[model samples]
Structure formats: C-alpha cells, structure tokens
Target: MEMIVHNPTEGIYAATDDFVHAIEVRSPSRFLFIAGTMGLDSDGVPGTTLEEQLELIWANLRVILAEAGMSVDNIVRLTSYLRDPSYAEANAKARVAALGGRRVPTTAIVAQTLASGWLVEIEVVAAG
Candidate 1:
C-alpha cells in the first residue's frame, strides 16, 4: 500500500513534526484496526508508571502488529488516551521511537482510564 500524507501549507494550522493532519492509504491489501491497548504485560499486569507503561504499550503493539504480518511501518494512524495531559510529550516521543521517526496522523487526549494505574491507552490503524 502507498500512504500519502496530507498537510496543507496554508489552509489550516500546520502539523507538527511528530504527526500529520491525515494519511491516505491507497490499494491496501489489508487493514488492521487495533483496539485500545494498555501497558499490560504478557501476564496482564499494568505498569507502575507512565513511562513504564509507554514502553510496554509499544512492545505490546509490536507483537500485535506482527501477529497480523505487519510492523510499525504499516501504522497509518494512532490515537493515544492519556490519563494526564502532561503525558503527551512522553507518548509522542515513544511513538516516534517505535515508528523510527516516521510520522503519521496521530492524536492524543487526556482522560480518565477505566482501571487504576493505567496511565495510557493507545489504539492504532495500520494498512498494508
């Protein structure tokens, strides 16, 4: 599949280096819509801190993507639900690291998590 990024120069606010306004996928043979993923380990335990959770979340995402025969490069979009707004920067950095600096359409929102100690939840859309 071919991914085309959309970030117009003048019509709206420019997108930051970490994310684009949108991604257009063309001729994708498969699409993977990952559900909200938390920073849970293989044994289903939440990480104690936001940073730990971010690390686990990315590792978990890698496994999930691999199960679908995809990798971080297949990620076309990402949405992060953060327990606090302050976690946004860390989350963005983790995302960039996971995707090897490849930017895509992304969003992050501060909100309460369903479970205690769950600092963040991430969902992804991948096409390949």
Candidate 2:
C-alpha cells in the first residue's frame, strides 16, 4: 500500500513534526482496526508508571500486529488516551521509537482510564 502523508502548509494550522495532519492509504489489501490496548502484563495487570506502561503497550502492539501479519510499519494512524496530559511527551517518544521514527497521523488526549493503574491506552489502525 502507498501511504501518503498530508500536512498542508496553508489553509490549516501546522501540525507538529512528530505527527502529520492525516494519512491516506492507497490500494490496501486489508485493514486492522485494533481496539484500545492498555499496558497490561501477562497476568493482565496495569503498569504503575507511565514509562512502564508505554513499554508494555508497544510490546503488546508488536505482538498484536504480528498476529495479523503486519507490523508497526503498517500502522497508518494511532490515538493515545493518557490519564494525565504530562504523559504526552513520553507517549510520543515511545511511539516514535516503536515505529522507528516514521511518523503517521497521531492524536493524544488527556483522559481518565477505567483501570486505576493504567496510565495510558493506545489504539491503532494498520493497513496492508
């Protein structure tokens, strides 16, 4: 599939360098709409810290993507639900590391998590 990054220089506010305004995928054979995944351990326990949660989230995402015959490179969009707005920088860093510095369209919002310990939740859309 051909992924097109759309970051218009005019007619809209400029998006941060870490993410683009939108992504347009062309000729994708399949699409995977992953649910909001949290940084839970093997025993399904949420992480106590944002860093730990981010780590687990990316690891879990790798496994989930692999199971669907895809990888982080196939991710066209992502949204992060952060328990605290302060976690945004860490979340962005982790996402960049997970995708090997290849930025796709992304959004991060400060919100409360259902689970007390889950500092962050991430949902992604992948195409292949």
Candidate 3:
C-alpha cells in the first residue's frame, strides 16, 4: 500500500515533525482500526512511571499490529491521549522509537485522567 502524508502549504504546520496534517492510503486491501491501547501488562498491571507506561503502550501496539500481519509502517493514522502535559515529551520519544522515524498523520489530546492509573493511551488506524 502507498501512504501519502499531506501537509498543505496554506495550513499550519504541526508542532513536531513526527506527524503530518493528513494521510491518504491508496488501494488498501484491508483496514485495521485498533482500539485505544493502555499501558497495562498481560497480568493487568499498569506501569508505574510515565516512561514505563509509554513503553508498554508501544509494545502493546506492536503486538496488535503484528497480530494483523502489519507493522508500524502500515499505520496511516495515530491518536494519543495523555493524562498530563508533563508526559508529552516522553510520549513523543516513545512514539518516535516505535515508528522508527516514520511520520504518519497523528493527533494527540491531553486529558485529565485514564482508568487504572494509565498515563497514556494510543489508538491506531492501519491499511494494507
């Protein structure tokens, strides 16, 4: 599949280079909409630290993508929710590592809280 990132010249640019304004997937044979994944482990234990939680969230996303025979590169869009503004940097760092520098269309929102002390939650849309 060919994924095109669109950043129109007339629109405001993203604050970070990690994402584009929009994404277009061409001739997708299949599409996957992943639910908001939290920073919990297999045993239902939430990570204690922001960094730890971010890492776990990425790991969980990777597993979900793998199960669908996809990878981070197949992702066309990403949405993230964070409990605190302080966790933004950590979240970006973890996302960069997880995506391996592939900048897909993304949206991030800062929220008050999440269930079970999760610092972050991520949702993805992939096409292949």
Candidate 4:
C-alpha cells in the first residue's frame, strides 16, 4: 500500500514545517483507527512537562502501530489534544522526531483539559 500526501496549490499552505493538508491511501490497504493515547507509562504515571508528555505520547503511538504491523510511515493522519497552547511547539517537535521528518496530515487542538494530569493526548490513523 502506498500513501499520497496532497497540498493543493489553491489552499492555504500549512504554517508549520513538514506538514501536509491531506493524505490519500491507495487500494489494498488496511486502516487502523487508534484510540486517543496519552503520555502515561505502563505504571500509569504521566510525564512532568509538555515535551516529556509529547514524547511519551508519540512513543505510545509507535507501540500501538507496531502491534498492528504498521510503522510511522503508514500513518496518514494525526490529531493532538493539548491542555495548553504553549505545548504546540513541543508537540510538533516530538511528531517530527518520531516520524523522522515524514509529514503526515495533522490537527492540533488546544483544550481546556485532557484526562486527569495528562499534558497531551494523540490519536493516529494508519494505513497498511
């Protein structure tokens, strides 16, 4: 299966680096809709900072993907929920690092709160 990323010329360009407006997955693909994942470890301890939480969330996503026989390259979309707007940059940084610069269509929402003490939550859609 192959994923095609599209950024139409007529649409407003994405403000962030390494991001696309949309992604298309070709036929013969299997899709996975992962539940919103937080930054909690196996012991249920959350990360202390925005960056730390973002990193942990990304790691958790990777584990979920791997369990489905998919890797970050198979991800077509990502949605991030942050407790504070200040965490946006850290979110982007962790995403880029986790995907190794591959640009996946993404949406980031600054929310009033997320699960108890979680600083960030991320959900992903992958095709394989």
RMSD per model, one decimal? 0.7, 0.8, 1.5, 1.6
Model 1, position 83, has a per-residue lDDT of 91
Checking candidate 1 for backbone clashes, the offending pairs are none
Model 1 Cα lDDT, one tens digit per residue, 1-128:
78888888797998898998988999999999999999999999998988899999999999999999999999999999999899999999999998999999998988889987899999999999
lDDT for every model? Answer: 0.93, 0.92, 0.85, 0.84
The true-versus-predicted C-alpha distance at residue 82 of model 3, in Å, is: 0.4
Residues 23-91, model 2: lDDT tens digits: 999999999999999999989987778899999999999999999999999999999999898898999
Off by over 4 Å in 4: 114-116
Query: Which residue pairs overlap in candidate 4's backbone?
Result: none
Q: Give the per-residue lDDT of model 4 (tens digit) for 1-128.
A: 76777787665754457688888788835889999899988788898877767778888888899999988888889998888888888888889999999998899998866466888888988888
Clashes of each: 0, 0, 0, 0
Residue 117 of model 2, lDDT score: 86
User: Which scores higher on lDDT, 1 or 2?
Assistant: 1
Order of quality (lDDT): 1, 2, 3, 4
Off by over 4 Å in 3: none
Clashing pairs in 3: none
lDDT minimum window of 10 residues, candidate 1: 2-11
